[model samples]
Target: MMKNWLAAGAIALTAGMTTTVAQAQSTMIPGENVGLATGAPLPEGIYAINTFIYRSQDTAAADTAINIPILVWATPFVPFGGRIEFVVAPPTVFTFSRVAGGRDTSINVGTFVGGLWAFDLGGNVGVSFLFGSYLNELNAGRGGGLNILASNTYRAGAAISYTGDGYNLTANLTYQFYDTPGRFDGPNGIPAFFGPVGISDALNIDLTATKKFGKFEIGAVGYGTVNLDPNILVFPAGLGVAPGRLGRGGRFALGGLIGYDFGPFSVQAYVARDVVTTGPRGVESTDGFFRIVAPLYTPAAAPAPMPAPLVRKY
Candidate 1:
């Protein structure tokens, strides 16, 4: 009789879990295109909008993960051609596996860092530094979501682009270093299952191109990453099966973007698909997704004309 009662209660709890989330196998898409416009200096002002969804995984498996991030940013340009950018994103909700898989399937919910800076070098080239950190507390599981909310992550890279004659091309290369292995422990403080066994530094390369056609623009962008440490690729974290092991070597993705520029404010929608994988034995994922970013730039006054060019000097 007691067993029957407990099973009935579990059924009721499972049925109610649907209210927490919609589907378990959610698609992994790209983040919205924030500032793909001319890439030129804009008037100092604040920009806010729905940055779009970042689909990290999309497998037919019973479990899946998805992230919905909202961004608010402020850009201030100094007279010396330098720019200060401040940004913050809240929630960054992440759900692992499926709701049907039960509450035990869920892990943590927290905020992530999405801020960076651009120091101009006259033309369309600039050296930029970026810093991103994850702050998530283990809500229902062990390991406290260590990787989701450990110390902050910092990355520095250089970028160059040409925005001339209604054409734009940009390329960037960055290296990522982690402060910790982002591990997790069980209730007794022993290591957990999903936590990182070992982690090594990595490198990334990104490229993008766009062409303007009146008010509408079309283009594509892609990125690839390289794994530096072999141990990090083949230790206890190895995907169990030999095929899944190669999935750690590296990865690449590409997609299309469409935009409409209207004066100071422009709206851009992007649809990118993962075409290839850099992994060895085909243990990687090839899930494709979509994203959108509408940046509303504030209006600025025209620069003052050079007054009577140095008449006294002559």
Candidate 2:
């Protein structure tokens, strides 16, 4: 039940506690795939997991909130001698700024869907690969002014893990490609200091090393993220505005996680800060995360113990 719980995928940026003028340039948010043995394969069953990833991006920049619910199913049949799992997650986004007495707004976002294939390579080592898309429905007339979530993103990634001796060492890598870098759901797109802006491609990697002792678990976790291309100003596709070189910047964070298993349910939590910052102001803030994984259904064991009764020799 403690095997590869969740893999890697890109969603959006963080809405920290402070207020600043920071618009997300990269699509992949760091620390989204921390804790858990995210690379290993789960046994054949159906499970539900809620992992909250908070970002303190750009220290007092405006803040956003998101609630994402995920459902996963490990299929009974294996393809190419590997386990195949399917996932679907849709998130509700809430954006609010702490200026002018705090303005609040809400909008419809995308649903994340992924198809992952995981394999166990003996020695309790597992590897998996996945492909997915974030189909964002950021239509107009929703409201105005918010650059917190990236729309129309495609993601691909891989994960590997070694779960042995009640310990887990795992890492997951996700690369996100954004189609509309300077686009949004509101009538106003990308609240820029000047004009519209865009971020090209980005990559994120999450690492975890943990050991379990009895019902308690402890681990160290971290993540590093970078934009693959230069940040630039954007315009409509039809409007031919040749993009120019802007700049490249990224961030790195480190933290720790602890968890406790009670019967068939487990909960984990962690907090991390941007230990290294190289981009916008207020990008140096702390993020705390919490997660819960529980089983919703399970396949019946084979052969059972004879549904009726066994005859005894009298």
Candidate 3:
């Protein structure tokens, strides 16, 4: 029963995690999947997960606003009785900066595709693992787009869930694989002498613990991101350092979540603010997030045969 209940939150975390934080772009957006069991295996069906997220800026200069439309298909080809899932996401990015009078431009950053394998470990516990890639992403400040990273990044993530007695506890994390020797993803890649102009490796962790009361659910959620490498801002060749870097930078935030399930669909929302910032606190904005998870296509129910006509002969 508990494992069945956790399915409501088995919402997988997709790539396209393009958002600005601590003055850097991350491979996976932090704190976007709070209060959900992102580690559990979803049932067989085509599903959609839409997320609206923003970083609040007082002046709206170089603010972060994103809308991600993620499509997931949980395939019926259960391997070893586990679920296999595939995902695709095409995200929209908005520029809300006031250079002269600010502009609201929606830019096509790129697309994200990945696959997942989830296993049910019995005892209301499940584990999900995934590997995905972010493709066609232009280098930051290049290709007339808003992306900050010039190198296409790859990510490996996992989610572990434990549900019991109407409780949902999950830990999810993603590690990014990338290197910015020179502007890599931009058209006509920039020379390495331009200096290392992008971010180094990093990791994101989101933790959730919540309990359901009938149809209402409430919990406390926390998220943190850390840069495994600890360089610093991009500098010119005079300094002999990369053009820029955000190594050794980390941020952590905590917030609350309240959501309700409407049988066929479910919704969850949460707000978290930076509690600890390790490196530079360039933009410490309070973040707001709203998410919707629902099945987009389900197998049609088998129809019952028409009863034999009146039996008039009898």
Candidate 4:
């Protein structure tokens, strides 16, 4: 009788502890490709699709860049189960001209991203690695339709995440590299690097936080980067192909997302604005980036009960 009472007391203690853990809230980052810690019970054979799009307008000659990225994720609900996330974006299409009549006048297309892999580290801490490449440039001539960057590149990164009590926090480091310099094909004799390739191997560190209250969730992100190999903002469309003339490259963004989750599915809209920019031209509109994410898939349905109910009312 004493052992039974002791066991019952321990069970109550554990339940109280878990309840306390659930009462503390958290936040998540905004963006499709980036990992947002999911604090729910991991479901087996779960598949989800996400779409992210961002458009930034800058005062630079290239003026604007629109990025449309899609992602597909699959996870099996084992204790140490794994998850895979990847982007399915076509090349980005845009125009650039340093001078009004310099005449590189043509549309250009950049490459798409490959798949990325993530492994759950238990307790809401997930780690991920990239298994993909980005094109250097693509042909955007008369017959061109969404060409990729020719100087394809590769990337890898690591992240630590924690999700509990309606709150989520994530810190990550990403390394991106391209083998070639100022090598890209553009429209009508226009050089691929006409604008900012923003390339040249760099390490990016980012932090994100999110909190959920009832049906509404809100969050913010902080990002920083260090150029391992500093080179001029390579623009294939330039005349002298000058290096070191371009301004420094570093940036900070402040953004938030407000959304509601219904059962196993949810939808969110977000806006991120650059508070500080390290582009060659200081705070040029050409580099002002903003993105929106939408749902690409609905979750699975609840399972049906067995033939008989577990408990009889009689």
Which candidate ranks first by lDDT, i.e. highest?
Answer: 3
- Candidate 3: give the clashing pairs: 98-102, 139-150, 140-147, 229-247, 229-248, 230-247, 230-248, 234-243, 234-244, 235-243
Q: Write the per-residue lDDT of candidate 1 for residues 177-295, one digit (tens) a residue.
A: 55555554322121133434344455666566877787677788675555555444322343343422323455566777676656544555655555654444322333232333334
Better of 1 and 3 by TM-score: 3
Q: Rank the candidates by lDDT, best first.
A: 3, 2, 4, 1
Q: After best superposition, candidate 1 residue 49: deviation in angstroms?
A: 4.3
lDDT of 2 at 173: 85
Q: Which stretches of model 1 miss by more than 4 angstroms? A: 1-42, 54-80, 91-110, 113-115, 120-127, 135-151, 187-196, 233-248, 262-265, 280-314
Local accuracy by lDDT, each model = 0.40, 0.61, 0.68, 0.40
Give one clash count per candidate, in the order shown: 5, 10, 10, 29
RMSD, one per candidate, in order: 13.5, 5.7, 5.7, 13.0
Q: Cα deviation of 51 in candidate 2 (Å)?
A: 1.8
- Lowest lDDT block of 10, candidate 3: 184-193
What tens digits encode model 3's per-residue C-alpha lDDT throughout 44-114?
A: 77888788887765444666667878888888888887898888887776666656765666656557788
Task: Say which candidate scores most in TM-score.
Answer: 3
List, residue by residue over 224-285, the lDDT tens digit for candidate 4: 54445445444334535544433345555566655565545555555666566565544522
Error of 1 at 138 (Å): 9.2
- Candidate 4 has a TM-score of 0.61
